[model samples]
Target chain A: MTDRILAVVTLNMDIVAGGAPIFFARNQEEQVKMARYLARTLDAMVHDLENGVYIIVKH
Target chain B: MEHYLGTIIAGTLAGTVARMVMLRLDYRQYPGYPHGYLSHLSLGFIASALGAVAIPAILKPDYTAVTFLALAASQFREIRGIERKTLEHLDENELVKRGSDYIEGIARTFEARNYLAMACALLTGIAYELGRAPAAIIMALLSIIFVRTFMAGETIGDICEVVPAKLWFKDSILMVENIGFINIGLKEIREKITAEGLAVLITPKNADARATIHDLGQRQAMAHTVTVLLGTKKDVDLPEFTPLARIDPDSGAVGLYAVPVERDIDALILAVKRTPVLESARSRPLKTQAGRMAAR
Candidate 1:
C-alpha cells in the first residue's frame, strides 16, 4: 500500500499560505470564485488538504 | 516460458522506443536539458513494455500474424497523433520546460509509466486465457497499486482542477476582490513568474489580497516557501504596477530578499518550479464543475 504522488511542477513556485484572507470586491463566495479563476489562469493547483486550499502554481 | 519472454521483451522495447522517439522529438524542440537523459532511459523502458504487450498479444494467439498487422495499421494513427500533439507543445517552450524536466524525473524516475505499462501487460497476459473482465480486474488492481505507490509523498493537497473560478467560496476568509460580506474561505495562490536573465524568474503579476494567494507568513510552520520568484532586481514597484498588499509590484531583480511569507520548502519548490516537472504534474488534474468555468 505505498502511494507515491509524482509532482512535476513546471514553473517557479512560491507557496502563499492558505487561509490568508484576501478582500475581494463582492461577497465571500465571490472571493473564492475570483480566487478560483485566478488560480486557473495562473495555472495553479488548488489542493484541498490540511484543512485548506493548496493552490499550486503550474507555471 | 518462451512466449512470456517474448511478451516482456516486446513490451519493454515498445515502451522504450515510443518514449524515446517522443523524448527525442521533444528534446529537439527544446534542448540543453542537464538531467534529461535519465528521463529518456526510464521512458524508454516504459515504451518498451507497452510495445511488448500490445505487439505480442495479437502476434498469433490463433493467427496472431494477421491480427498484428491489422493492429499495427490501426495504431499507426495513435502513434502519429501522439507525435503531432507532442510537437505542438514542444514549440511552446515555456509550457513544456518544466514538463520535460519533470516527465524525465517523475515519469521516468518513478517508473510511473512502467508500472502502468506492466500492469497493462499482466492484464493482457491473463486475459488471453480468461475473458476481458478478468483482465480488467487485474488492471484495476494494478491501477490501485500504482495510485497508492504514487501517493506516498503526496501532501494531502489540492486535486487537479480544470476551471477553478476566479472567485472564492461565499464563506471564505481569503478573497482578493472586495466582498461586502466576510466568509471564511480557503486561501488561493495567485501570481505569475516571468523569467528575466539567468536565475531571475520574477513574479511580475502581483496580488493585493491574501485571498488571492496562500502566502507564507514569517512565523507559520507551513511557510517553507523554497523558490522565491526573483529576477535581476530585488523587489521594485513599477509605475504601471498596482500594489498587491505591501509588496511593491517590482520587476528589476538585481538583488535578493527572503520571501516575506511562509510555506513548505520542498513542496514550495515542487509547487513553483514550473520547469515542466511542475507544470505537467500541476496541470494534469481532476477539477470540480464549478471550479473549471471561473464563473462561480
Candidate 2:
C-alpha cells in the first residue's frame, strides 16, 4: 500500500498547511488526542514531526 | 508381474515415507491442518507410484513409460504456483506480512520435495531389483536421511548472532540499540511501548550474510516469523504496535522491535534465530574478488 498523509494534527496551526485536512489543537494533550483519534479512525500511524505537529500517515 | 511386486512395494513405501518425514508442522504453521496433509500425502503417493513403475517398465523393455516422468515434472510446477497464490492471498490479511521472496522460497521447497520423493522411490526400486528386501530397506533408510539433511536450509542463527537489545526513546523516536525506529507521537503509546516492547540486534557473521539481511523481504520475513511465534500486540487499527526490522547502514546489523503478547525475552530471541534464510534473499558476494576486497 502507498503511504499517504491522511490528516495533520498540530498545536501550532502555522506549521502545517496543505491538501491534507488539518486539525488545530489548543495544546499538546489535545493534539495527541486528536492525532490518536484520526489514526485509529483511518487505520494509520501517528508520526511526530517534533515541532508540535503530528501527521497521521497510512502506511 | 509377480516378481516385480517386491520392488514396486518397497520403492513406493520408501517414497511415501520420505514425503511424510519432510512434511512437518513447525512454527511457520502452513499446512498444519488435516486436509493439507491429506492432499500433500496423496500427491506424494502418485509421485512415488510413477517412480516405482518406471523400473519395472524399463525391465519389460517398455521405453515409452519413461516419458511420463516429463509429465510428472510439469504437474509439480503447478504445485509451486498453487502454493505461491495461496500464500499471497493470506498475506493480505496479515499484520506482519511474509513477503513475496519468503512465499516463493516456500513454494519452491514444496515442489522440490516431490522430486526428492521420486528420487527416493527410484533408488529403492533399484536396490530392491539388485539385492531384494534387505538392500531395499537399507537404501530406503539412507535416502530418507539424505532428503532430510539436503532439504534443510540455513536459519538466521546459522549465519547471524541474535542478541537482546535495549529499547529506549530518543525524544519522540523509538530506538533499538543505536538504530532509530519509528516516531511515537502519543505519550501514552510511547509509555506502553517502552514498558512492553522487546528488541534484538542481528549481526551477520560474514559479508554474504550481510547482503542477505539487507534485503527488505528478508527483514519482513524475520518480522513475520517472530510475530507469528511470539504473538504480536498489534491489531487492525493499532498499526503503532506493528513489528519493524530496520538495518544499521554502517555495521550492516539489523535491529528488530516488537511488542509481543507473551513478553518472554528468551522465546523472542529463539523465534528470531529460527527464522529461515530465504533463498531469493541469499547472496554469495563474498565468493567474488570485488566483494572480498570491499570486505577488507
Best by TM-score: 2
Clashing pairs in 2: none
| Candidate 1 C-alpha lDDT tens digits along B121-182 | 44444443344445544544554454345533322123211111112233433222222112
DockQ of each: 0.04, 0.87
Fnat of every candidate, listed in order: 0.03, 0.84
Residue B224 lDDT in candidate 1: 15
- The best candidate by lDDT is 2
Task: Write model 2 residue lDDT over B1-296, tens digit each, in one string.
Answer: 78698888999999999999888623263747788788889889889888988899899989999999999999999999998999899999888998899999988988988998998999999999999999999999999999888777889999999999999999989999889988887888899999999999999999999999999999999999889889999998898898999999889999999999999989989998989989999999989999999999
Model 1 misplaced stretches (Cα beyond 4 Å):
A1-59, B21-111, B117-295
Docking quality category of candidate 1 according to DockQ thresholds: incorrect
Weakest ten-residue segment in model 2 chain B by summed lDDT:
B24-33
